[model samples]
Target: MTKRRGERPPVPEALPAPVVDAHTHLDACGARTPEQVREVVDRAVEAGVDRVITVADDLDAARWAAEAATWDDRVFAAVALHPTRTSTFGEVEQAELARLAGQPRVVAIGETGLDYYWDYAPRSAQHEAFRWHIDLAKRVGKPLMIHDRDAHDDILAVLDAEGAPDTVVFHCFSGDLPFARACVERGFVLSFAGTTTFRNARALREAARWVPEDHVLVETDAPFLTPHPYRGRPNEPYCANYTLRDMATLRETDLGELATKITRNAERVFGLRDAAKS
Candidate 1:
């Protein structure tokens, strides 16, 4: 991993506590039951993360994510049909998503957007499904959490034309400085994940540096992009500290300031009003 300026190298024991993991799939992280969720969450909480957003990318997973969120105050939900799951969605899928959105626990409408990496679904279907997710967010009065892969132009065009929720976030943002600037201009939030810590992610680092303090957010996208030093192992919410620290260093800011800003950004973008009450 490219070491962030002043990063004290990867020593898990030396990291700070009480960070926020803005995006993840608790269920997909190999945790299938409530007890399992608690185990993972316990580890994260012990590691100092205050909350974790568990994103569901499919109908069943959405329900599971919502249940997990409802069961634990530390967890929040993002519900939608992922780009690859578009084929499974139609009238039934849409109705299910809308139903799930009605639940207070489901704060956002995504983990949606385009993904050209695998092209698991047809491009046309991906666009159509993506539009549905965008409209769902608008209708539900929640911010949108997008997942774009090698489809920046298309994603931007769709968001520009379709209009987004009051708050829009590029989850695990994968774009260069120009895209970051454009998103900032449109008042969108850029969330960096472990990819930002990759040794080759100079473009992402530049974007991180340019993003406004309030507009920057960090996440682990865990069970996936495990940050360096733990890159080969399975990632979890606690690993987000690496991302938070990396973002702080990349933006040339204090870790405390960056952590606070990102925590607030997560709350703002997700429409989370009651961290404790919920």
Candidate 2:
């Protein structure tokens, strides 16, 4: 079913336990202000999605994400220059990102990595920025959240070459079973987004089932992949419940049990010790 513009799907029944949206872009979802962020997060909470890591795609977005985290305890930030925007990466942007990455609210250095599907930046420039972000994640001792598109091979190769961070997550993972196995073998966490619920994403569903409970994660990637039945609509964290429920069905596990597992996995990867406090 296609979603109408400016329309949002109804919130699904809340899960037995809260689940974290491993990655989302609150700012892109039009939650640019503190009040707007709270509104969105509140709705998410009601749907059993209590925490989210809002990721930035550029310098301006990075600034907004870091600031947004301070507005609500349920929100955390991941700052980086997205692979598509790497064409503009330089000393000034890098320095600013480094500053944001050090903030207490900034828990990850990511939404970085390769996106070969878009030629917004040259391959060389994207590679350079990916290496830099990888190093930054390592230096900050934070997990690296990747945005791999059609460039899976290069994404893995670069991470291997740079010696990946202590923890790495493939945000909105779109790979097949073999690729999923490769990532899991390297100890990388795979975050399944709304796309996993789509009927056309058979391979992705297979990969989701293949992943171990500890290595699996869930996200909305909101305002983008809005999950099945609500595909093409504007998405928000609250909609994560749909994806979580679908994942549980795919794994043949109890929804509540899976929610608990995904939440625990998120806490571990993002080092969110105070997650429950929020």
Highest-lDDT candidate: 2
Report each candidate's C-alpha RMSD, comma-separated, in the order given: 3.8, 1.4
TM-scores of all candidate predictions against the true structure: 0.92, 0.97
Tens digit of per-residue lDDT, candidate 1, span 158-201 = 98898867888899998999999999999998888988888788
CA deviation > 4 Å runs, candidate 1: 1-17, 275-278
Q: What TM-score, to 2 decimals, does candidate 2 have? A: 0.97
Give me the runs in candidate 2 sitting further than 4 Å from their true place.
Answer: 274-278
lDDT of each: 0.81, 0.92
Q: lDDT (0-100) at residue 170 of candidate 2?
A: 96
lDDT (Cα, tens digit) per residue for candidate 2, span 61-81: 999999999999899999999
What lDDT does model 2 reach?
0.92
Cα lDDT of candidate 1 equals 0.81
Error of 2 at 214 (Å): 0.7
